[model samples]
Target: MAASYELKASARDRVGKGAARTLRREGLLPAVIYGDKKPALPITIPLKETTITLHKGGFLTHIGVIDVDGKKHQVIAKDFQLHPVRDDIIHVDFLRVSKGATLTIEIPVHFLNEEDCPGIKKGGVLNIVRHTVEMTVPADNIPESLEIDLAKAQPGDSLHISAVNLPEGCQPTITDRDFTIATIAAPAGMKETDEDETEEEAEGEAE
Candidate 1:
């Protein structure tokens, strides 16, 4: 499930370049939460707080409880803009969600057992084809990340989405085919001995 974070915000009466610029000058970030059949709620969050959360990776996929005027809104960051030159957030858009609503979100993939992977032990390189997978899941059951086990992977092995274990009620959005998630290939500049060893390893695995 996605972890939730709390953010304090205040209602904003105006929305425009002028108002946004003024808010930034005052150390606030202009934002909006809209969805679930409700009117868009224009708000502003403290620049410092926003910056801190932005630094904590995966803020976009994580659920957020935005408190505005003591009212809480369950949201997920849908979009955001960063300053072209400055290291700051300029604007953000959020989508309100109900606990039971299903949503499509891209969740990161975390590979495990690399040290024990047969391919890595034989000097193979891990090539990540998809760092994240888009999945449709219950809003309240979003997994933090999809785990891919590489314990049995060998060189020339291509890991596909079909090999992953998704959480209950979660499935990949791309259903046309079982897409490749990653691959273990022979490293660049392989020597003759390495090539022979890799082939022999593969032959052994086949048996």
Candidate 2:
């Protein structure tokens, strides 16, 4: 499930690069809350607190409540800008989420039972194709990560999106086909030996 947090911000009366810089000088981060058919609200949140939340992980997917001058708004971080040199979060754009709204976000993938996986047990390498899958999920019900079980995975077997059991309303953005997420790949030498064995078997049969 998606986690939630709160942020305290002061309503900003100014907008533009100069105003943003001024806020930064005052140890605050400039931010805006828009979307959901409402006018954009400019605000400034404490730099220290916002930075802590940003580093906590899953900032984009987690729901946040921003209190602007005591007026609270439920929002999700849609975008954030970083300083090219300093690498600090300079600005943030949050989108207001209404009830029953579905959002397109990336959910991280987590692998399980690698030790017991038939492929890994045979020294097969687990090659990850996609680290995160873009999914269309409900705003109120976001999953932290999508898990893949490798207990039965065999060497050279491909794990596809069809293998995951998504949440009730969660759906992958790619609808065309069952995409490959990971693979249990055979080592180069193992593949070569297997090919040679197959060829020798074929030659003996022909004799």
Candidate 3:
């Protein structure tokens, strides 16, 4: 099941830089909802609610039920404007979504059972290259994350995007067959140094 977040908003009568600054000052964030053949609606949501929702893992891809002026709309966070200095959200943009629509989103990847992996036990370092991958899946079947178990991975073993088990109706957007997600590498010292030099040479030649 997909995770859902409830957000309450109210229509904003004023529109301008000054109005937006005022809203932020009053503990509200300005936002606009548009998509699915609906006109864009300007509104304001509580700062606390926005902060909490954004803090959730994979919040941008999570389906949100936004209540504005007593009407509920299903939407996905499309974009946001943040204050450069304060690093706070100053504005938000939400894209309305329908139940039958397929949404493309990036889902976080989690590695499990690392300690039990034979590679780690043999002084191998786990190198994770991709932390997230883009996927196109049903809105209702979106997964919060992708889990990979490395318990039996050996020193020379590698995990690719193709090896990831996705949820029903979910498909990785990447079609490359040889793309690696995680790999086991030799630990610090001579072996590691030699491996790094080899990798650097390979990279230099490729470039």
Candidate 4:
């Protein structure tokens, strides 16, 4: 699970391109909090603090308690706009989420025990098909990443999404079929050698 955070923001009295530009000039970023069957609220936050949070990473995946004019809203950063040349966050959109709401997010996949895997130890290459898996999870129980154990994985073994152990209340969005996540394949040199041996065998049979 990701750690929670609190962001301080001031309610915006005016909302428009002009007002947003003025706030940016004053070193503030314009933001909006909407959803949960409530009216959208326009707000502004400190540019410095927002920049630091963005640099820390996982702002979109983690839930944050946003304080706007003494009122708190549990939300997640859904979308953000950045200045093309300056690479600054100009505007952001926050989606209010209830505790029991189910949300879809792409969680990163972390492979473990690669050193102990017989395939990897025997010069096999690990080919990753999906670096991240999209899943539907409760708002408050989002996982940081999914771990896949490769302790017994061997060469020519393909790992599918069904092999992963997900946390309770977390389900993959892709439920139609068991998609492959990774594979332990033979190295290019090994593949070439096998092809050469097959060709030699075929020539010997033909002769």
Which candidate achieves the best lDDT against the true structure?
A: 2
As for lDDT, the candidate ahead, 2 or 4, is 2
lDDT of 3 by residue, 1-207 (tens): 243888999999899999998998899999999988889999899988898788765568888888998998889997888899988888889988897889888888899998898899988889998898888989887787889899888776789876778799998887766578899886666477778999999999999
Q: Give the distance in Å from residue 147's predicted Cα in candidate 3 to where it truly belongs.
A: 1.1
TM-score of each: 0.86, 0.92, 0.83, 0.84
Error of 4 at 12 (Å): 1.8
Candidate 3 minimal-lDDT segment of 10 residues:
185-194
Q: Which ranges of candidate 2 are over 4 A from the true structure?
A: 1-3
Expressed as tens digits, the lDDT of each residue in 19-132 for candidate 1 is: 999999999999999999899999999888878887897777888889999998999998889989985799889899986888888899999999999998888989999999
How many pairs of residues collide in model 2? 0
Better of 2 and 3 by TM-score: 2
lDDT (Cα atoms) of all candidates against the true structure? 0.89, 0.92, 0.86, 0.89
Residue pairs in clash, model 3 = none
User: How many clashes show up in model 3?
Assistant: 0
Model 1 lDDT, residue 7, Cα: 88
Using TM-score as the yardstick, the better of models 1 and 4 is 1
> Looking at model 1, which ten-residue stretch has the lowest summed lDDT?
186-195
Judged by lDDT against the true structure, how good is candidate 1? 0.89
| Candidate ordering by lDDT (highest first) | 2, 1, 4, 3
Ordering by TM-score:
2, 1, 4, 3
Best by TM-score: 2
- Number of clashes recorded per candidate: 0, 0, 0, 0
Q: Which model is ahead, 1 or 2, in terms of lDDT?
A: 2
